[model samples]
Target: MTSRRDLLATLGTVSLAGFAGCSALPFGDGQDEKSDDVALPAATVEPISWPESPFPVAVPSTLAETHRDRARELLTAVPVDPAVPNSAVAEELQSDRERAADRLETDTQEPWPTQELSRWRDRRHAAATVRGTYRAATGEDDAEAVTERRRAVRDELSAFVSAHEYRASSPLEAVLVHAPIEELVSDCRRRTRPGSGYPADPVADPFQAGDAVGLVEFADATLADARGLRDAYLADRSNTSAQWVPLSDTSEQLQIALAHTRSTVQDFLEHDEPPFDADLDGTAGRWLFTEASRRVETMAEEHDVYRDDGDYARAILVAGRTLAAIEALRTTIDGINGDAYRDEVTVESVTRTAERAREALAAIDASESPELAAQLCRPALDTVELLPEVIEEGYADAGRVQGELAWAELYARAVPAATAFVSERLG
Candidate 1:
């Protein structure tokens, strides 16, 4: 293995190579007189590739049969609330089952096939039985009933996790299988206080379906993941005789790479012409920078948590993913134009964009012929009216909110002719 110093030196070379293609472009939107003279630094991006698929492993035919039988037994026995005739959790489970039904079909790769498909199909049928018992659980007046059912379901889930330890042949394989399961269990353990004053609901309704169907789906996925991990571990173990690299070495390299990328993004925003004008202009650019920064910070936080828990393998996997996200952000940043479409997708940004659209609408309403103005800008006005709902109910992430803002701005700008006409009449 290369020393950390040597690895970083190699990364620096790659960063400089990436920058070579970008340095010649003129900085800014032709707004600054000295923009043409500004020199651009190379983006400190490292080349991080995803793990290769562990295929062509020898799988025992009986493995699938055992999995299918186990899935049917577990799912058929899941409990539900006695009183709630119609649960929102049931609707959610049916939807999830339908969405996952397609995974039942086997892919081109084979050898250990039929059992996985059977397991999925059996789980789907079991879901029908689950949705039937939870009616009326979604109503506001039934919050107590929903919480009661949730607690019951959570108790079962906690027991399941505690009783089963899904292990694999290798550390990396073990990390992949256990991480998602542990994360789910941790969420289940959190105490939900009614007036906790958190940003949003810690989990979805009924805690993202603390119901029979949801529990079965979770069990099936966990088992499937464990199966896949076992296969991969066996394959890798057969193919490679070398020992795994030291965790400290990889961790140090990731730390240096993250710092480098963070600094590069900061440098661009600070020194580039047109500035970091997220409020009025370059919204996408600002958002890209903000998200990239957030991801870098998150990677560091994840690393700390994993290390403290002595899960070095999981930390390494997270670092790889973080690098990939940073690389993608850098690519998007390179493509940014002088537009607000990609601005930081926050509640504030959403509200601001909606206000700008409202101002445009007011101008049209105050025109010499209000009726004609409405006729001319009907589509724009319709889109602007929908903004209040978006403002009231925030989005899942920065990307989604950013896209909404961008489209809203696009629709607002589409009515340039109507706005111009209104201004002309008023003048």
Candidate 2:
């Protein structure tokens, strides 16, 4: 009966400690200066060495010979596209970047003077002036206006800092820039059109525009790191001989899968269901609700396979969070007892199907046989496939069911095509 939080906490404690230990050893006393010197033979005193290049010298590769080509292939497979930018997510990320630029400018322009108290007082006064201006321009209860002003302030600060020729002196520079940017992006992408007919509350929607942006950023960074590693390994590939390759072909397979998953999720978010019932009440709500449930179930099933891989945890977390949000929406639909909302019964039934799919996912063990995992995943997939029918039947009104039916038709057509593509590639 351990909760997800409990499991995550345990995993964090164990995994982090294990990784920390692998990174370093206990420090010891400094070596004697005499021991560091090495005497050259008298015959080699003139010291004739290999010619140095005027350009940067290429370092020899460090990886074992067997892994060189595999590493190359992996590096080549890294996706280069910046994530497809959603305007809302872009705005959030830009705001974060501006904030960092402002902070950097302020710190550089008004560094501590000789007198601590004087410096502190000066900073306080400057901050107060800025605050007064902000408040005057954006009154209380107007969050959007406040946000825009904050962004403007940050942009101005960044420009000032850049003009001042201040260099990044500490690790905090990158931290300040990357952390907020990542967070804003994650938040913006979480829910698509928050108040859409989807049964889930806008607050609880799983897909954050921000998270999508962050994932793309993370993937790009990982690819860069991998490419550097590959280049270094390949530089010395000729001299080293090894029993087994250090880089596996599986890296390419995993990258392709990740790219596909990102694309699929993005597609879902941008997708617009055809106009259904004129009323945005029960019929429309039920259709959107069922679609949301099905999408969540599909994503959860796909993510379950990669739970064991450290890099895939973000995807797994996204899927789980989305599934939980859909579940909550279902609960909300069930609780709507008013006569006007009777059509929401479909939302309840589809939600049960989603829960069953989630249960199947929880039962799956990545460590188990691949065949078994695939078998388990099929039932979950089947459950998702049933959602369209549930919506179509429950909302028997032709106009109300149009959008839901179209999506279901698309899902049915696409799944087989996708399956065939995977089968052929893997076969």
**Cα lDDT, all candidates:** 0.39, 0.29
TM-score of each: 0.37, 0.21
Off by over 4 Å in 1: 1-224, 239-245, 266-275, 278-294, 327-427
Q: Model 2 segments beyond 4 Å from truth?
A: 1-261, 264-280, 284-307, 310-412
Query: Candidate 2 at residue 215, lDDT?
Result: 31
Per-residue lDDT tens digits of candidate 2, residues 6-120?
Answer: 2223344234213212110111112212211222122211111111211111322322121323322322322222121344533433343343223323322111111121222
What TM-score would you give candidate 1 relative to the actual structure? 0.37
Best by lDDT: 1
**330: Cα error in model 1, Å:** 4.7
Instruction: Quote the positional error of residue 174 for candidate 2 in Å.
Output: 43
Clashes of each: 10, 12
Error of 1 at 197 (Å): 22
Report how far off residue 30 is in candidate 1 (Å). Answer: 29
Model 1 scores worst on lDDT over the 10 consecutive residues at 42-51
